[model samples]
Target: MEMNILIERLQALMAKGGRQILGIAGPPGSAKSTIARGLAESMGRAAVVVPMDGFHLANDELVRLGRRDRKGAPDTFDIAGYRALLDRLREGGPEVVYAPRFDRETETAVAGAIPVGPDVRLVITEGNYLLLDTPGWADIRSRLDEAWFLDLGAEARQARLVARRVRHGDTADAAAEWVRTVDEPNARLIAPSADRADVVIRLDA
Candidate 1:
């Protein structure tokens, strides 16, 4: 769908005059953050993005659990915490609600980094597992007013993933290997959840 049309749709939803949550779900490197940020920018103060990446487990915790290598996998996040934030966003109180944000530079979650005030009408949350039916993740879909799955060709998506890792300081060979052994498996797990989304969108590169 065109970005303009999606913006219009979100505007219409916001017109109802209560907080609305929109979830954008897709595999790694599907540009979910980009799209969510674009929508929030277009909407100005009425919208705020609270990304699921912020729920990522600390690197220390991942290492302790022996899951550091598969850091982006399903179990690598604090799903309960993520869900609790969604609940608060959905409830909409008088006070400001602060949300965590993931810092790629340090690879850690920065607490209370993004604030969602009471006046914000829409909360756009994007992540890989929003539509997953797994134990902790299945509750996510029900919290959103709408859910969108971003789709991209596997080869193109994988290439982007590799490039991202390299840009983040991984050697080219290490990035390629990580994409093969780690990201690809997560992508496969995520693909099936697309069927659960309210809309599957394929935006142009």
Candidate 2:
């Protein structure tokens, strides 16, 4: 699927008069967040983004558990916390829900950082593992009405990721090293989840 196709489907769904909770999943640096932002912006106020990164464990906790080195690993986040938030969103009840937000600069998830209002009809939650139907992750699919798997061309996503790491304070060599060492492996693991997505998208810059 292309980006325009997604926008078309979104508009169609909106026209049909039912809320669409669309999930976008992909490997690290695959442009899931970028697509989510675009979707929300295109949808206007009816769409709000609630990121899965918001459940990232705090730095202190990760350090305490000796998982700082593997900061973006599956175990480094509070999956249950994310689960609760998704569950609430699925219910679509009245009242505002304040969710945590991940800060890349600080590398931590700050509580009550994003406010999800009562009237938001669509939510775009993007992450690497939302479509992963693994042991502890089976709960995610049930929470989302539909999910899209973002598939960026390898060279493009990797280049974007390397530049991102460099911009965020990593030396060029170190960032490349980190991307190859940790990020690439995680990206490989996330690919399998694409099978579970309702839509598979190949997005390009």
Candidate 3:
């Protein structure tokens, strides 16, 4: 829903006992990272974010699998790597754990990058596949204490995705075509998992 309500919900969750993990699940263009950042900022130092984009396979790895052309598709990522990170983070291992971070311009994961430290209690991890039940991602929701799904209009989302691709160096036509063809199918498949979320929110107008 709205930002104020979302912040309140998070605050309430944070107030509860023990450690809490918040999973923000949405389609590719749904602005999940933006919301996660905003919420963490609002909460000040208590919240820290770890994005799922870090799990995306490098360009070379994608090429090895012959899936470079379908980068946003399910099979293009390193699913086991992501699952392992989640498991490690959940176990409360070392004083700090370095996670991968995706660079949009380069379209690759930079490893040992994002740091999750001992002080941060609430982990806000946003990703498209957090709610997906396919293979490695199936146990994802169980690991997260709270999950939210961001809902946005299809046409608006497609526009955002197209603009993002274009800004990241894809030709305008190519961006639009990729949004229509590749991303939208994934979005459709990802949408149903909203039902699994504890909260469903529509972005502001």
Candidate 4:
């Protein structure tokens, strides 16, 4: 989608809305967070971001479950908590709703970090599993007013994932290995969920 067209569509949605929730779903390296954050930034105080990353299971919990190696997988997240929070956002009651935020350096989620005010019409959420057809994720589609999927090519997506891992302090070799062994499988699962989105955005175009 062209930048102007995307912004205009969002503006129109805001104009017609009582409460509007936008979900951006895609593979790990597809830049879902980037686009969602950009939209909220452009909309200023009228929009707020409530990222799915904030639902990540703490590292110790993952260790106890023996799933630490597969940290980014769908099952590793607190899907139930995420869904309940989305429900609250959809129902709209609190004068200020507190949501969690993920800390990359610590690789954990901080509770009550994002304060979403009642006046905000748009709640922008981006995550890998928003459009997934799995049992736990199915109801997410019903809660969203609109959902967008970022479609990026395989080569570019892997490259971006590798770069992100390195920037987050992973060694080059470790990043490549994790992308190959872990991220790729998750990406394959996520790619098919694009069909469930209201819009499939081709970022490379």
lDDT of 2 at 34: 81
Every model's TM-score = 0.95, 0.94, 0.94, 0.95
lDDT per residue for candidate 1 within 1-205, as digits (tens), equals 5888888878777877788999999998888998899999998998999999999999899999999978889999999999999999988989899999999878889999999999989899999999999999998999999999999888888899899888999999998999999888999999999999988998665
| Model 4 lDDT per residue over 107-157, tens place | 889999999888878999989999999988887888888898989898999
- In candidate 4, stretches whose alpha carbon ends up further than 4 angstroms from where it belongs are none
**Candidate 2 Cα misplacement greater than 4 A, ranges:** none
Q: Relative to the unseen true structure, what is the C-alpha lDDT of residue 45 in candidate 3, on a scale of 0 to 100?
A: 80
- Which residue pairs show backbone clashes in model 4? none
What lDDT tens digits, residue by residue, belong to model 3 across residues 8-119?
8988898895558899999989999888999989888877788889888878888899998888787877778877877777777557978898888887888988888867
Q: After superposition, how far is residue 83 of candidate 4 from its true place, in Å?
A: 0.8
31-74 in candidate 2: lDDT tens per residue?
88887998899878888888889988887889899998998888
Candidates in order: C-alpha RMSD to true structure? 1.3, 1.6, 1.5, 1.3
- Candidate 1 accuracy as TM-score: 0.95
- Per-model CA lDDT versus the true structure: 0.92, 0.83, 0.86, 0.89
- Candidate 2 vs candidate 4: the TM-score winner is 4
Model 1: clashing residue pairs?
Answer: none
lDDT of 4: 0.89
Q: Which candidate is the best by lDDT?
A: 1
